[model samples]
Target chain A: MATRGDSAGMNGGGGVLLLLRKDWSIFTLRHRIFVLTVFLMAALQAVVVDEAYFLLGVALAAALAVYVPVIEWYQGTDPMLHSLPVKRGTVVAARHVVTILGMATAGIVWNTTGRILRPILGGGGSDPAFWMTLEGGLTYSLAVAILALLFFPLYFRFGMGRGIAAFAVMTLVLLAVGYGTAQLAAGPAAPGAVGLITPSSVIGSRVDTLLASVGPAATVTVTLAGMAGAFGISIGLSRRWFATREF
Target chain B: MDAVLELRNVCKTYEGFDLRDVSFALPHGYIMGLIGPNGAGKTTLIKMILNLVRPDSGDIRVFGLDAAEQGASVRARIGFVHEQPTFYEGLPAHRVATTVGPFYPAWDEAEFTALAREFGLPLRRKLKTYSHGMRTRFSLAMALAHGAELLLLDEPSSGLDPVFRRDILGRLSAIIAGGNTSVLFSSHLTSDLDRVADYITFLRDGRLEFTLTKDEVLERYALVKGDMSLLTAENRRLFAGIVTGEFGFVALTTNVEQARTALEGQAIVVDRATLEDVVYFTGRTGEGGLRLNGNTR
Candidate 1:
């Protein structure tokens, strides 16, 4: 004899858990083969090129995180999910939590697999390349998480097809800006500086500076605050947008 | 009898259509059939009740709770079967149940398994592999497994076969027999509703044409067939809609007694209108004159 009051709140903690399970099921059920293929490729890349595995893993995480909501929207399951007893805000919250967990797991797997395979591949143990690759995976994941949090509000507001189109336009603009910045960063004499300025190096240097400047505690606090702020804003926007949506 | 669901002056406007001041009530432990032609806003009204789409004005209450403000809580005691019923297409029925079951506090796994078996749904096969009818049946199975006080089904019989439709209706009747669980399903299949619906709500062009007991609906309208001589300007108003051919004319009337009195000795035959006849004629008329299938006279 379960009553309606059992699962009602701003977050609906119980509802969020159920929604996360359901969302995870939907993700795994629909994309198991693609996931297995991604992992298989990561493993093979780890054996041949250790650095490629981390890049591939980070890319896989972002892709999967975006893919779940995109498919849910495209398939028109959002209406069905909303028709259930779950809070609309809880649904959005559950999805964000699941995405973060999934990406974190992907990063961990990449690091662990690369570490295990490096010794077998006859590489120097604990090399700089290996450490940088692992750290690069984290940096890429964090950046993607921030972008994904922003991207989701669009997806929630406009739905899947238009959301993807918006995402594509945003990606193109970011790429254009990045290219222009790199060209500016490297004057006419240094055409290859774009390649010289690897994402890992820039991201790695930024992390080092931030850590050295403010100490570990401040660095961690700032990181958590940024994530929480993005999450809070994204959830608020999505909830408001979703409430007015006509299904 | 308590109203399990009630909509009071519910109104919603779309780009091309509008649900205008619609209202109805389904008493507890009874089946209410929402009947209308395609694009007549049966689905729209249901969506408003479910809060999938908000009403432009008015209120919907389910089990005495405001539907919009308490949407999540209201939905907890309700089960919905969508028209198309999409799911994780790659997962089997059992797996889907497993994933979705915990959302409902009173979900009964054993009952779900029993219903799945009873519906002849292949538990191991993926939903993508199920036929349209099977998918609908699966939706019905899911709707019944939870201890839902009310079930809202949008065209539950559209993709089902005749036998399955009858079976589903029978099962719904059986559910009502237990003294709980009201059902509100929208469909063009009036015969299925006639078989089991205790209450009937008719929608025409987003307006509530009528909402009454099935007996009252059957009694409230009549079909009249007569000759051209009886098609007088004064007599025409009595007919809700009429169609004329070479020999004579056929018309529908909401008030049979008045129609008989008006057309006395005019060589007219009045008969009880079936639910289909009421839907067809009332929905197929126009201004200026009587409308043929695609013509006006």
Candidate 2:
């Protein structure tokens, strides 16, 4: 073999895009049924119950985000990919890009399905205009992002098995804290407010007051921006962590 | 640039094993067989060369470029075939090729298709469905399809039948016929290496026992057989992995000429040593296994 310096095959810089295409080819189309089932469940729940059925959508999207990485992990081929012409950073980039794309696709599916059903279900646009179909999709995404944003970095850092265990622990800790704070906030209110106190009611009342003060658009904008920033940071962290990792 | 691949003082330490101070060079347009027993650091050394594992401290250069610093570019000119099908098992053979083909800028789809057809691979079947021999064939086809200048194969012929093994070895010989591609083949089957390899690097217990040309190994190493009564203290020092049975004694000597001189006119037999004998004796004795008395080291 002559030195590869003069070789025609050493196209530099496009490894990331090449890796993305390969990963997408293997990962996306194979799970068509799962993606369909998520949307189907979201649609059924929305038509049967209420707009708050987005909670189910959020749960579905989060399940997908968590589960997508596991398939590739189970195949145990990522290390072999490292031996290919692609850079390690390119592998990490492709994974993060695929994950984010899956989330965006889920968001689109959630929004599209809700728009189709809202008229039939008679939502009647009761909330502010900003809380329309797209915002609801964004809310669902942000909720999933809360869990997924924590997951990817863990996956890159500790690998799939240990990372999932760590992610579960972190999720449990966050839920316990959220439950405690909700309990404290839902205690009996002062001076004859005359309302049944519940954790969702307390959080909902706080969100209402905040929306009234800042307007729904502003609140959505800030929340989406925060999630975007966190997602960006998570991407950077995953890339760095995966670069030095060994199979 | 004369050597297609080179390693200098490479070292990697795991929980229970360490590949220490491994250094060798593979000249261009030739085949180098990496032969060692199990856990002999054969796979670990190959992984280090491929940059799949990090070395504690060392330099690995491929095609005269640092394997780590110019890793992507270096790898673009190289093709690797793992011992197992660590591929997307759910995807069909054709899809797996499509998934892997584009990374090589010179990847030839027609070449891959031809190889797949030649190997009798069913394109639509998932890799999970393929047998071990089929997967090995698939891996070789993938490795050969892209006009790779260097091929690093880890046990590529492990589970193959005798006919396919000969066919694969013939293909390897044909590829190197052009004097543009080289191969570093790691295998437990020494008979295969004796058939095609121009150079042999024997590693045992994470340390290299010797890296010699085929002629050099054949010329300098020998297998000796004599009566058990001839097992003198001085004669025993020159033998490694000596076997004594009711029939008599059989041992490996790294210095064929010295053994010939020391026991001239005696009732003993000195015969040419095969690659298998070298690996077997050296591996039987583990590291520092050679009792060459500095003649063949």
Candidate 3:
């Protein structure tokens, strides 16, 4: 016969695992489709578009694909989960871990597919081409990882509906600011610079300069720090919000 | 003589209504029924006990543990069946058991399967497809499989048919026969509780009107019917409420023995009050009036 203490520990661990399994089950259809599409798209892009652009597309697609599960995870059904014997903090942590793992797996598939197709579609017999391709993939992964880590916390804190609105408004503001900065950077000489400037180009430029000026090690450290900070803040907010929730 | 559950001045206030200074205790090895009308704060009180909602004032102790401080630990020993069974709609019955079973250390898969079979539940069918009665049975099966020390049921019989309700009550009686467990159930179905509950707690307008043993409730309150001329000022003062018709007067009295002796000559009939009559009488007149279904006197 299991004692009470033994039961508590067993149930706690089992509850988290069971909940994660349920979450993953719901993600099966959408996640698999998104991963497959990303892989195929990355492979095709490698054969046609610039290698840098192919990796960037893969990164962006992987980041956006995460939204499906994140939104589904926080809907009206969560009250059922809260009713279980699991702690609120554990519930929040488990969700974050699941989302992170899903996004990371998608990122890896995108990067690997890009790598395998790059050589076949290269412009010339450039030396150290594989190393250049690896660098581009890593840079894109780091940028996407940071963006996901930041945006996900907002969703967790405010819920899926409000989170989407907040994300859209923020994206629009960033786009406006990015266009304004590009026109200023062009020093009134470049034609249609405002229309030409994209938010991604501005972000890509800043990231490229930081990588060049401070070396890969420093850039990697800063990116990791940013990821950690975003994750930490999101977890804190989620915990507080869930703790006070009447459900 | 440890109390299995205790609620001390537990008060929860909503925008329009308030559960004011509610207090009660259930000793171990007894079944207590929480009876109330619709929107009488039964669910609110249960939610507070489970720590699903915070109480504005008061303390709840379950199994000698502070309910708020040891909520997770307390909940581990509790089996709850809500009015409407809430489960993963997409999951099958067996899957639902698998997901919730591990949460209780004492969860018995064998017992769960047995009860499911006994209730004629289809383990392979998705919960969304189950009928209301079937869903109630599934919830009861899950609640019982874990050997829970304390069972808290909120309107568990609302959608259940008469036969199924009897089955559920019979199972609960058997479960409580072992002398180590207790149950607190809330229902608007007074007859169901009257059949099983040893103790009854009545709530009205978010306050406890009375909490007494079933025998005591029957003993203390009497239904007296006689001519209206028999209702004297002093006799009417002793009784809680009176219904004076053209020919007779019927009233509910707290002191039945005293009323019987005092009005022996004037009273035409005096009978024991059933639990339904008690609930109906209390509900109609918050002052504990007589519910004259017909002019028997």
> Best-fitting candidate, measured by TM-score?
1
Docking quality (DockQ) for each candidate:
0.42, 0.39, 0.29
Worst 10 residues of 2 chain B by lDDT: B286-295
Better of 2 and 3 by DockQ: 2
lDDT of 3 by residue, A1-247 (tens): 3322353563356555755776665554655687577657656655445544444554545454454445454434454555556676666777666656755665666556555666667634344442244345445555555555555555655666776688678877876787777678877887575654432354455656778889888877865676567667767877776666564
Q: Tell me which of candidates 1 and 3 scores higher on DockQ.
A: 1
Instruction: Report lDDT (Cα) of residue A63, candidate 3.
Output: 53
Model 2: how far is B48 from its true place, Å?
1.7
Chain B only, TM-score of each candidate: 0.95, 0.94, 0.91
DockQ of 3: 0.29
Better of 2 and 3 by TM-score: 2
Candidate 3 Cα errors over 4 Å, as ranges:
A1-15, A25-77, A109-205, B226-251, B257-264, B286-297
Off by over 4 Å in 2: A1-13, A28-30, A38-52, A63-68, A115-136, A177-211, A216-221, B283-297
For all candidates in order, the CA lDDT equals 0.77, 0.75, 0.72
Q: Chain A TM-scores, all candidates? A: 0.78, 0.71, 0.69
The TM-scores of all predictions, comma-separated, are: 0.87, 0.86, 0.79
Worst 10 residues of 2 chain A by lDDT: A1-10
RMSD of 1: 3.9
Indicate the residue-level lDDT of B143 in model 3: 83
lDDT of 1 by residue, B141-258 (tens): 8888888899999999989999888888988898899988999988888988989999999999888999999999989888888876788888888888777766677788989999
lDDT tens readout by residue for model 2, A1-247? 2112222332333665666666566665647776687668657655444435555556556655655467678888866777887776666666666666767776667666766776766664454222243445455555555555788788888889998899899977877676666556656563333344322243345445656788888877876786788678777888788766777
How does residue A228 of candidate 3 score in lDDT?
69
